[model samples]
Target: MFALMQSARLESLHLSVDPVTGLKAVIAIHNSQFGPALGGCRYLAYPDDESAINDAIRLAQDMSYKAVLAGLAAGGGQSVIMRAPHVESRAALFEAFGRCVEQLDGRYITAIDSGTSTADMDCIAQYTQHVTSTTAAGDPSPHAAMGVFAGIRSTASWRLGSDNLEGLRVAIQGLGKVGFALAEQLHAAGAELLVSDTDAGKVRLAMEQLGAHPIAPEALLSTPCDILAPCGLGGVLNWHSVAQLRCSAVAGCANNQLTNLQVGDQLERRGILYAPDYVINSGGLIFMALTHQGAQPEAINQQLLRISERLTGIYAHAQAEKRSPARVSDELAKKMLYGE
Candidate 1:
């Protein structure tokens, strides 16, 4: 399923794949009135070229909304590199991507996305100077996870009417960089934890590091918890899955978590305080925005703290208006885009 629901506001889009260079990339630029496009580079295996193109278009559209919500000056764009697990490719893929970016010439600045890391960006930098990886000085996952944790705290405080989560039972799905960092923060706050991952190494690491209970990925969502954190992929909460979840609140760092707008409202209808994914996942965007603005980590961190406030405000507004958080957040995002 595609992430974009369809909108006439969309200005332009582009998609391509370079086979001769042993590179498969789909780059889409959605809107650029604010400035040149900037989005993450995701390495993944798609079912077909159409799937890759669809993901590129959808994520680029999401980037437009995300950029506006984060109050950034750049437009939206995203690139996806299709590859099999450990499939042989090279700097050639990035170099070919660099060539694509050069053709665009600053219209799209590549950043480290899923299936990619900063080290990958190091290779990508050889091709284009407009590229950006999470130069977080420290581990990017911790920083990325910190933003999500801060958002989670704000969400729990707003929803539960309690800022102290000494005995809160939280289930984290995904022990990747973001998940591990979030688990660390939650553990520090005296929260009971249950974490799981597809990677046994990461699961073992989380078990050793945070003393979390390991479980299969499919079971993580229904594992009877106060808050369900999905820091992995999109479309985790959908028509078939939402009705089965037992969490009090849904919050995480993944983009496009809901299959559609109505599903978010369904969660709200079920008395599940759903923290809008776009709103909650703004941490990464916020970090990227600040970096794009040439700010230091301290300055960026200080600014990121306000996300708690922004999320809190959104929560309050949603409650007061009897609106879904997704709708409320989208209203806020659209306001930014429309300059209303």
Candidate 2:
């Protein structure tokens, strides 16, 4: 535990177990250089406690980089709830989790992430004030999708010599809230959609409603397309998938899309333009952070659109320096956060 904390430069790690509600949670604070640590609470089934801890730590670190790159006056933290079999009483579980967040006393703020929802945030809000994405704030998935759409346009402009998505083939690997919303945006822009998801119902819905061609989940990565958008989970772009990717660019809403730095290098070698995940996928975080500061809705909407500008700068720098966009983004974020 100490090794992981030290390696990730984590400032704090808190573990909470509610025997009555059967909630086991880990909260990791990666940095507080800019301000209070801010991130979301992720609820998911994990293989083991060690895996959960590793995920919390790694995600917290990414949040730190994400905040710095987006110029948010906050640090990075994450909360992970381990979903166990026969878990009973979600309200009790989240209330207990909210208490854990309350104990942090605003040092870390919690929002919604995958496997969690706005309703869950509303439940959590019943216990603590540090939570966002409540019933009033609504879901941030659409805003996140907007950012990804803007990123796709910028990337398309650089890679395909046009910013238009009309008739451009885009294979989206998830049809969840953000992915489905993104599909709506792309479809309205006249992009050809190939979608996949574990849920057959979602895949079928995409096919029927949006005219998206449904691909089996297993075949999403290798399907020939102009862009491969993995909006589901992280670690999907490892060496094996990178070698098999048949796309000009990869950009989506998933966090930690690359397994490691070397995988990003491999994508560069393969001539795939990877819009660094943290840089392009920061829209939701930006929305949450700005809303937390009581920024007006119009201001938040305008700020979210700047994601394309930020990505364009990163792409330009990558081209000028002859480096991968991932490397350039990492270096720029580190310079902003640590001046090194």
Candidate 3:
């Protein structure tokens, strides 16, 4: 693990284990060059401790690049709690986790992500004030979905020759908070929706509420659609899956959508426009950062509007340079962070 961290150039790794509350967590700070580290607390069950540490390290690095590209005055960090069979004492676990955050002494800030919720943030806030995405700040998922929606429209405008989503077929491969909210926006815009989720209830909800067609989770990528939106977990667009995609473009709120950097080249070769995941799904981070700084709601919203504009410029630059959008975005983010 030390060798991996050294190879990845991680800043620091902190592990906290509380036997009484059964809380086992890892906080990985990837960078603090821009400012204090800011990231979400992801509580999930990993196969092993190594998996948890690896996830924290990778996610923390992504957050650093994401913050720099989004113009947020924060660095990158992530907290991953290994889930166990102690659901009855979840609050105690969170409180213990909060204490861990407090120990960071403002170097790392925590927010809601994946298995964690705003209520969980509230629990963490009890032990430390360095938290965001609480009830007071409202849910960041909708804002994230909004940014992805804007990116999808921008992609359509560039690739399909129009930004209008009317009658456009969109396959959404997840019905989580952000995915469902994104479905609402796309449906309102008259887009034809094909939704899938591991949860049957969520798929049913989309079908009943948004009039979306149901697609099997395993078949979401290959399903014929104008756009493929992956709002679920990462690594869906791997080398094998990239060859199977039938969509004209890929855009969603999921982090690290591509399994490897080479997948971007594959997408380009397949003639599919790829919206860089961090660039498109930065609304949540932007919201949490500005809210932490006490920015007004309007100011937060206006900042989110820049997401689409940034994506548009990236797409245009990619076209002008005849390069992949993913490559272009990486260069831009690196230039912003390291002045390369």
Q: What are the per-residue Cα lDDT tens digits for candidate 3 across 1-340?
A: 8898987679899999988988899999988998889998999999999999988988898898889988899999999999996566888889999999999999999999999999999899899988899988777898999889988999999899999999999999998999999999999999999999999999999989999999989888999999999999888999999999999999999988988778999999899999999999999999999999999989999988898899999999988998899999988987877789
Off by over 4 Å in 2: none
Candidate 1 per-residue C-alpha lDDT over 70-129 given as tens digits, one digit per residue, 9 for 90 to 100: 677888888898885554567667777777777787888878778888877767777777
lDDT of each: 0.78, 0.91, 0.92
TM-score of each: 0.92, 0.98, 0.98
lDDT of 2: 0.91
Give the distance in Å from residue 189's predicted Cα in candidate 1 to where it truly belongs. Answer: 1.7
Query: What is the C-alpha RMSD, rounded to one decimal, of candidate 2?
Result: 0.9
Deviation of model 3 at 14, angstroms = 0.9
In model 1, which residue pairs have backbone atoms overlapping below 3 Å? none
- Model 3 TM-score (2 dp): 0.98
Q: Candidate 3: which stretches are off by over 4 Å?
A: none
Model 1 misplaced stretches (Cα beyond 4 Å): 1-8, 84-88, 134-139
Report the Cα lDDT for residue 167, model 2: 99
